[model samples]
Target: MEPRQTKLIIFTAKLIAFLCFAYLTLAFFPQYAHHLLLVIALALVVIGAGSLLKYKSQRNWIESEAKLLSSEEQEEEIAVSQYSKLKYYYPVIEYAYSANGISYTGHTLSHEKENLWVPEVNHWGDPTPATDRWWLWFEPGDHIPVYINPQDHSEAVLVKDMTKARRSHHLALLTGGILIGLIWLTLVVLNYTLPLR
Candidate 1:
C-alpha cells in the first residue's frame, strides 16, 4: 500500500475512534453533553477566526520579482482497494528572489499547503486537456510575481489570497464555525425554552 493510503487509513481510524468515544461518553454522561458541544462550538469559532486572521496578514506581504528556477509535475498513485487506484498530479515550482539586499530561493506556489493537487484528468467536468499541466505555465528564467514576508525574507510564495484554493479553505472554516454556532445557540434556546422530560 502507498504511504498516502496508510496515512488516510490511520486518519480515518482515529476519527472513527474519536467519534465512538464521544458517543459513549455522551451516552453515559448525558448531562455534560450540552456543555461539551458548547465548548466545541466556541473552540471552532476561535480556530476559524485565527486562521482567517493569519491569511489576512499574508496579504500585507510585499511583492517582489522572482526568476523561475524550475517547474515540474509530481505524480502519485494511491490504491483505493483491490481493483481501484487514484492518480493525483501537482506542480512543483522553484523560484529565486532578492529582498533587503539578500537573495533567497522559495519552492512554494501559494500561501496554502505545499502539496496542492490539481483536478484529476477529465474529473469535475474540467475542459483542460490532460497534456496541459500546471507546470507548463512557466519556464526557467521567466519573471513572476512573488509575495515576500517583510519580517522574514526567507518566506515567500508565488500565489496568495483570493485564489480558488485559498477562498475555499477559508470558506470551509467560516462555514464550520457558523454552523456549529447556530447549533449551539439553538440547543441553548431549546434547553431554556422547551419543557424538560
Candidate 2:
C-alpha cells in the first residue's frame, strides 16, 4: 500500500482514539468533564506532539552544533534524523514492543518524500548514514506516542492501543447506555406488545 494510505489510516485511528476517549471520559466524569477536560486534553496531546517534534528537532540541531565545536569525534556525515522524541514524554513507555521485546524501539523517521535516507538508531553505537533496502523495512516514524509492554520489548507499537485498559473503559460506558434500552424494551413488552395477563 502507498505510504500515504498508512498515514491516513493511522490518523483516522487517532481520531477514533480522541472520540472514544472523549465519549468515555464524559460518560465516566460527565457534565463539564467532556467539554472541559477530555476534549481539551486530547487537543493538547495531539498538538503537543507536533510542537514537541519541532522543538526536539531544533534542540537536536543546537546540541549537534555544540558537539561539533566542543567535542572531537570521527568523521561521519550527519543526515536528517526522523521522528520526534515526544513519544517518551507521553504514556507510551508503559507498553512493551513485541518485535524486539522493547518498550520502545528507536523510531526511524522516513524522509522518502524529501529524498533522504536514514538508518535505524544504532544502539551499540551511533547510526550509520548509509542507506539501502534495509532502510525501507519498517514503517515510517510515528510522532504519536507509542506504548509497549515491558516484559517483551519487541511488542512495542505506535499509540492507539487495543489493550484491556482502553477496552474496559469503552465496554463500561456501553453497559449504561445498553441497560436503559433494555429497560425500555421490557416496559413496552408489558404495556401492550406481550400483553402478559
Which regions of candidate 1 are displaced past 4 Å? 1-24, 43-48, 75-88, 113-117, 121-126, 129-134, 165-169, 192-197
lDDT of 1 by residue, 100-143 (tens): 89999998776444225654544454555665565677889999
Task: Please report, as a residue range, the 10-residue window in candidate 1 with the lowest summed lDDT.
Answer: 112-121
- Tens-digit lDDT track of model 2 for 110-190: 211212222335444565534432322233331233433344434333322233443344445444445544544564455
Clashing pairs in 1: none
What TM-score would each prediction reach against the true structure?
0.68, 0.25
How far residue 48's Cα lies from its native spot in candidate 1, in Å, is 4.1
Runs off by more than 4 Å, candidate 2: 31-42, 45-56, 59-197
**Candidate 1 lDDT:** 0.73
- CA lDDT, candidate 2, residue 10: 99
As for model 2, its CA RMSD to the true structure in angstroms is 18.9
lDDT assessment of candidate 2: 0.36
